[model samples]
Target: MKRNDCILAAAIFLFAGLLSVMFFLSGNEQGNYVTVTVDKKVYGTYPLDETQDIEILTEFGHNNLHVENGTVCMTEADCPDGYCKRQGEISTEKETIVCLPHKLVVEIQGAKPNGGRTEEQTDGQTGEDYDILVK
Candidate 1:
């Protein structure tokens, strides 16, 4: 309605835009590793610092996971929707790519957990132990 009001509105919009940009670029920076899981079970753990291609095959289907330039992504998947491949890339702790149809999950962990744990230390069980309880 007035020149001063217009300038004030413009400044507020610009400030808001800059804040959003900063927040988007300041994502978590601690995690340097990725973990792959299928049907809630640990399939493999990979380092984000390395470049590699990982092929995962199971009764449900096949998925190709790729690690490069400190990022991890699902490069291919046989699931009907192929959503896993479209999840883009992840490099921060707690980030994940999920293939619901194949029951697959890829997550970023800040560090390897306790150099891994023994079966006994993990209550003498793993996800496999719950298979019979599922159905």
Candidate 2:
């Protein structure tokens, strides 16, 4: 290969590496809050920093969510499959625990520093900012 060709390849590789690093750092940010949704409706949003147990009882079923040490997990559930409990803890943004039978979803999210819901969230809309939507 010519010297110029090698230099161009090296620069491209370096730029790619830097771009990957930037995306990794930004995308994997730790989540400060957990949002619970049932049947596509907002149930509640809770802070991960606080140690608490959230008991959810719906006509479909019941679930126990335990939050501690900045991580949230499904500790108990009445679902037949028990898959949600097996999903384990989540502390990073976009991670989720879903109980298919109960139609319950617990997702990690990054919230404003003041610990208040954004205007969109308060207006009965989700606060998530989607980068892409697929059919």
Candidate 3:
């Protein structure tokens, strides 16, 4: 191949890689609300747009939930490791902050499904349904 041909190939590869990175970083869809669960049970669901402090008091312990600027995070917890406090803020669907010791799970829930499809239209279910199965 000529020198010009090699340069063109390299440029194309570089551009493709840049585009891939941008898409990967932007793939996270904005979440509309957050769900807090304790011991595998739904504790509460809070809107992301509302800024407030929530204290979760379960039999295990307490977790301080904070919502600010459309982001939810565990500001403080009584768990031994304090991992939940370090999990930081989340503002995207499927993102979660778990406190294993307290069995606390804080996860983001997207406002709507992709492609304007409702739950029934897409999966024929009005509520939660198992879709993925591991073989």
Candidate 4:
């Protein structure tokens, strides 16, 4: 191709590549919110939809919780006090929501996709074994 034509083509290619990169980077950001509670009280809110690890230690013991795609679950905790870990995984709008001493926990299942409206149907509930997650 002629010199001018070659330069024009290269510029177009560069712009397209740059646009692709920008779109990719912007799309990588997830925007879901989750509220965490400790001992029946609200503690904090954090980005909910992503695979990440958080360690919490209460007056009782320490435990590791995993947050992924708006779902939070216990992965590990101090074996001596297995309260948190034993609670198991929670992924519903109404969740476990508490930690006794280390004073940390979040059990919530709001609309999926962060803000999708839920049907709001319920049989009316509350039982230990019927929890959102079971160990």
Candidate 5:
């Protein structure tokens, strides 16, 4: 290999390493609350700092969510597969525990100043409000 090739390769690797570090640091802000959704509708949003048990009883099934010490997990569930219970704890933004059979989704979210969710967050939309159509 030539000298210039080695320098270019090292520079590219350094840039990639810096970008990765920045993304890791910026994306790891701890989530403040979790939003529970049932059948595509907002069930509720619970704070992570508080210790509480949330019993979600929907027509499809039941799930018991336990929140404590800034983390939340599914303690119990009546779903046939019980996959939600095995998803472990989620305390970072955008992490989720999903129960497919019950159509339930629990996702971590960063809080607003007023301790309430934005329209888009509560409405189950993560990004901008614009819609795109392609035919």
Candidate 6:
């Protein structure tokens, strides 16, 4: 293969990798997101986009859980281990902060699905489900 061909192939590979990362980070599933913090520091994140339940893990214990609507709350935990279940509910967009050991979690609800609605259609709507554009 010519040098030009090699460069073109490399560029394509890089572009594909970058796009995959962006899509993964974007959380295309469609729900709010949960942010896990440990000892007042951000630890990890989970997708809260209403597609499936959520699970959280920490040094102290592990828990299987789910969130519904806009509420970010905890329903169950490994009570036998004496952790998690007691953490309670956290619904809003960024309100419910959970503390499992040093693992502190915050649930951030993303805006409702846009359904391919253009900006023009969103204008003047009383009830709007729009995500804040950052950048």
**What would the per-residue lDDT of candidate 6 be over residues 1-135, giving only the tens digit for each residue?**
699999999999999999998998775645666655444444445655454566656675665566666455655566353344565666655455444343444546454433435222323121121112111
Candidate 2 lDDT over residue span 9-113, tens digit each: 999999999999999886566348888888666678898889999999998899999999989999999999999899999988778887878877787778632
lDDT of 4 by residue, 1-135 (tens): 599999999999999999999998766643444555444344445567768887766555666778987678778766455676667667665666444445455646453222212211211222231354334
Q: Please give each candidate's TM-score.
A: 0.62, 0.62, 0.60, 0.46, 0.64, 0.41
Off by over 4 Å in 4: 1-32, 58-60, 109-135
> Which candidate wins on TM-score?
5
**Which candidate comes out best when scored by lDDT?**
5
* Candidate 6 runs further than 4 Å off: 1-31, 79-88, 100-102, 109-135
RMSD (Cα, Å) for all candidates, in order, is 12.1, 11.8, 11.5, 7.8, 12.3, 13.3
**Whole-model alpha-carbon lDDT for candidate 4:** 0.58
Models sorted by lDDT, best on top: 5, 2, 1, 3, 4, 6
Given candidate 2, what's the lDDT at residue 32?
82
Candidate 1 weakest ten by summed lDDT: 118-127
The worst-scoring run of ten residues by lDDT in candidate 4 lies at: 115-124
